[model samples]
Target: MRQNAERCTAALSAAVSNYVDIFEHVEGQIIHAHQKDQERKRNCVMMPSKKLQTFLSLPKKQMKKSLSETSELEKELGNYTCALHARLSPNEHTAIKNSDYVKLSESIGTSVKQAKKIATTVKLIRNVQKQVKKPEINPSKEFTMAALF
Candidate 1:
């Protein structure tokens, strides 16, 4: 009877120790993940203007080009508005007011631009997917995928 009790006590002690070890391992993983996340967040602050300028250091011609594209798009959009207004109705004394016509033209332009943006974003994602290198798995080494947990 004493031997049986001793064995039972030993088993119980081993089980408790295993549980404590697993709990500690999981706790350590959680702490590690949290610390890594906090470190990433700390490193993401915006750089100062001087530092940013030094980092960029773009050529003057390239900078001029970037600025010009903005004004050019604005002018092109204005031309679209002018063409739309001309086709739709006269400037003054029309059944539809000029403000309403301008608003309608602006909304149409915005929708067209949004559609283009969605298309461009999709294209970019597809391009990135194409560029990504997939690990080569030998067909002979392939096994049935594991069932969902």
Candidate 2:
């Protein structure tokens, strides 16, 4: 009878230890996930700036093509005041409103009305580029890290 009691006590202890190990593993995973989430949030702060820079730096032909593609959709939807237009400065608004179609068309390498739209889009992109702060990097710190590696 005493041996049976000891066997049962040992089994219970083993089960308790197993449960503790599982709990600790799960806790560690949760902490790791939280840390990853925080790092993602930090990185996302500069995502808009990166996107804006990429768009602005595109080749002129590619930029014009992108603007033309969106212009068709804008006309179909009959939505003239887009998010980009909404953010335009007063001067940009006036420029688009009173733009010389022939001059703009020749300069932008597009049709008359499409040239106006492209000009507006370019202005909006430049405005956003100005507004979005670029991430600063310390060259000395980067050099130190590279040296460590």
Candidate 3:
């Protein structure tokens, strides 16, 4: 009876040990898989694709070109406004005429619709300028206390 009991105890110990060994092996495999996943993620983020670089650069270049074109258009519009203002009679309205837009379209090489839009913008700016008043400035007075310092 003691021998049978010892055999059963030995079998139970062996089974427990086997389970522990299997758990350890599984834990090591999990750690190795986690490390591999981290390494893959790092590589993907660090690598710069050619297509992505081009996609980013193209928009920047286009924005720069568009800005330059807008500046040029502004200068042209300013010149056109000055010329139109010069040709106006003293009692004439400041509003843009169809003829003025046609001439502007011809000068700026834009469509008449675009010229009309620009004319509207100029008129709005003039109206805003008329509404805004300059603040009055008072001359500064010298303080007598400053001489003591």
Candidate 4:
């Protein structure tokens, strides 16, 4: 499990850092192009896109919000993991530590008893869904005297 977690953590870290680096590189190129175009066109050029401007001019609150959102997204993405120990990226680890899962579970009324009931109920529902009727060994073809009365 530890090995799996380490492997997964390394992979996620590499992927996320790679993605962010690529985006920053692209953003830098856009800014550079805008600057060169402005100098070349001399007041006849389109301004940098709103996205670029927003990326460049993120306020403190927005920066914090974006970081929190990224962490949350990464945490949720953890659920899609099918292999190995739960390798958590740094952000996801932080998010999980910060989240009050116990409180949330309590608020949602998800106790051990409720969970047990739900599990049994789900099993029963699946049995009903199978729709397999058992064959009757003895056929009661004749009408009973009680029915004749």
Measured by TM-score, the strongest candidate is: 2
| Model 4 Cα lDDT, one tens digit per residue, 1-149 | 99999889988999999999999999999999777645543422122245423532555445445545676432322232211012222332233344544443343346645534433333332232232223323434334544666
Candidate 3: where are CA atoms >4 Å away? 1-4, 45-149
lDDT of 4: 0.44
- What TM-score would every model get versus the actual structure? 0.32, 0.33, 0.29, 0.26
Candidate 1 residue pairs in backbone clash: none
| Candidate structures ordered by lDDT, highest first | 2, 3, 1, 4
Model 3 C-alpha lDDT per residue in residues 56-129, reported as the tens digit of each score:
23453453344355665335434544654543333222225443777666644568897676566556535433
Candidate 1 Cα errors over 4 Å, as ranges:
1-4, 45-149
Ranking by TM-score: 2, 1, 3, 4
Worst 10 residues of 2 by lDDT: 40-49
**Whole-model lDDT, model 1:** 0.45
- The total number of steric clashes, by the backbone 3 Å criterion, in model 2 comes to 0
Superposed on all Cα atoms, model 2 deviates from the true structure by an RMSD in Å of 20.0
Best by lDDT: 2
